[model samples]
Target: MNLEAIRAIYKFEMNRTFRTPLQSIIAPVISTSLYFVVFGAAIGSRITEIEGVSYGAFIVPGLIMMMILTQSVSNGSFGIYFPKFTGTIYELLSAPVSYFEVVLGYVGAAATKSMILGILVLLTAGFFVPLRIEHPVFMALFLVLTALTFSLVGFIIGILAKGMEQLQTVPLLVIMPLTFLGGTFYSINVLPEIWQTISLANPVLYLVSGFRWSFYGISDVDVSVSLVMIGIFLAACIGVVGWIFRTGYRLKS
Candidate 1:
């Protein structure tokens, strides 16, 4: 079903990433390394352990999650937004490409790029602190699902955005704050009981919690709950995308 169209779109997007490795890849990797240096090395020196794992190691999953979520969404949003910004989208709309195939190409590329960054960050973590995966399979599962989910979220952002400034609004204003407060640097259990209850309301907590559980086998929320939350979010995003296509929301115009 228009497999070649999908490949062309996928290849073009991927090539764009390669062409701007500095902005697309190296910058995030370096920023994350600084996070390790400041948070993991500087702060971790004072706090030795959290839930039996070294503070440095404990933050690894959270950092990875942060990088992937931001990157996935950024890439997904930019991938689509650029086409719209440059008016290339009208060309694609007139092409014999189905909406599903277009989504697959863009979202798939975004997720793939996010995974690449995530894996690199994971490898980079090995040098700062000892790393272990209690459940490698689940770790991979969480990594893949999170990348795909957030990439789709970014895709939606791209579709909704009417200008360049609008593209950064959600990720910087909403997502970045959610991630920092979502147990990226500390476990929610250590917070006051009241705060812990409030933390449960933040969706990013489940993502960080379950991913951490895959690494250390301890979590603030039930692992199954995290999985279910991700599933729900992913399904919701897919539903929104389908509706967008059906109604030609922000696309036809």
Candidate 2:
């Protein structure tokens, strides 16, 4: 399985993170903390609870999901993109490593970083609001699955990107808006009936709903539907990655 090859790549990517702790770790943590401060203070004053959960507590899952999605994409995309940018990818390609091993290394490392950040944000939330997990196991499952799925998506974006601008395009233009509008700070049920239906089409809603369900046993969407959506996305990403490797799409160029 080329375990050593996978480990080497994983360690290299991870070391890059450690080398830029301010940009890679501290910056996101600070940004999320600001969300808690602004939203928790401003909105909490007006809306005390949503579905019997405090305004501050209600947003935790969504915020964590938001961070996980963005960071997973960022980490995964940059990890592979840097090598491509510097023309080092050819060396890795020439190594005695299989495509699966290469993907496992990059995506696995990205997911690990996202998970760590998610946990840190979760813990950081405790200081801002009272928190509880009705189903800890399911919460962890959602966390891991969301991280892994988006990490794979990021890997695809990395391979497809032609420049730094293209690499940042999806996460900024697409993901961020979907997340903010996807019931992050407020419940979709509060929206107009039409908007609520529209919100259902945004995939981030399912992730936030399912994660919130795991925490408070309340959700805007069915937990099963959320799980199914995540599985579908995961499978789609794996398919794309497999096709990329087989065709040597950008890698061989």
Candidate 3:
């Protein structure tokens, strides 16, 4: 795409996010803070160390992962949904912008928002616990990759959704359950051997484990496996999203 087209799409997507400052910023930060308080402060004191890190510290990566995944998904879902709802997407669809350009613009902005929220939550957690990063580069990589993966998922859902209600349902019913079951609050090692094997099926577990590895220099699952899983998820989402947009799946109808 030309620079002009790229600029237009980027600005449009960014403006949509900034338009609702509270929903985009304060809401996720506050909700995550509450998790830090309830789980990190209240429960952490009673639980002691988890895998050599303080319970409070152990949950920090999980909390950040949670915020990134949710916000990225929400941002991406809404980015496309609002235009479709307001009858403005026809302008976008007919414009000079390619589907690839459109995807990059929306996904880029969503990733930015996710990273911002991730950093904000990490900072907030620092106030309550002594936060440390075992691998800064790996931590950053996990954050970006996970955000992109979820943003693509959100894009698919946004295109499929018929109304505002459907937008909320996907995250509430699907994403939330996966996150909670994904070793967000505790280590998978704490589970029964059978349960541990089953929790391995959760996609979120790989994300959380990769993020945790970045924090404590250790992981319940191999960092390589987590990275591979994330890579595969990203690749799958990209392929599916490209197919959806290429066919104009729900967007054109």
Q: What TM-score, to 2 decimals, does candidate 2 have?
A: 0.98
Error of 2 at 155 (Å): 0.7
Q: Rank the candidates by lDDT, best first.
A: 1, 2, 3
List runs of model 2 lying over 4 Å from the truth: none
What is the model-wide C-alpha lDDT for candidate 1?
0.94
Report the candidate with higher lDDT, 2 versus 3.
2
170-240: candidate 3 lDDT, tens digit per residue: 89988888999999988998899999999999999999999999988868799999999999999999999
Error of 3 at 97 (Å): 1.2
Root-mean-square deviation of every model:
0.8, 0.8, 1.1
Clashes of 3: 0
Model 1: per-residue Cα lDDT over 103-142, one tens digit each: 9999999999999999999998999899999999999999
- Candidate 2 lDDT, 1-253, residue by residue in tens: 8999999999999998999899989899889978977888677878868888989889999999999999999999999999999988888989999999999999999999999999989989999889999999999999999999999999999999999999999999999999999999889999999999999999999999999999999999999999999999999999999999999999895
Looking at model 2, the pairs that clash are none
Give the Cα error of residue 188 in candidate 3, in Å: 0.4
Better of 1 and 3 by TM-score: 1
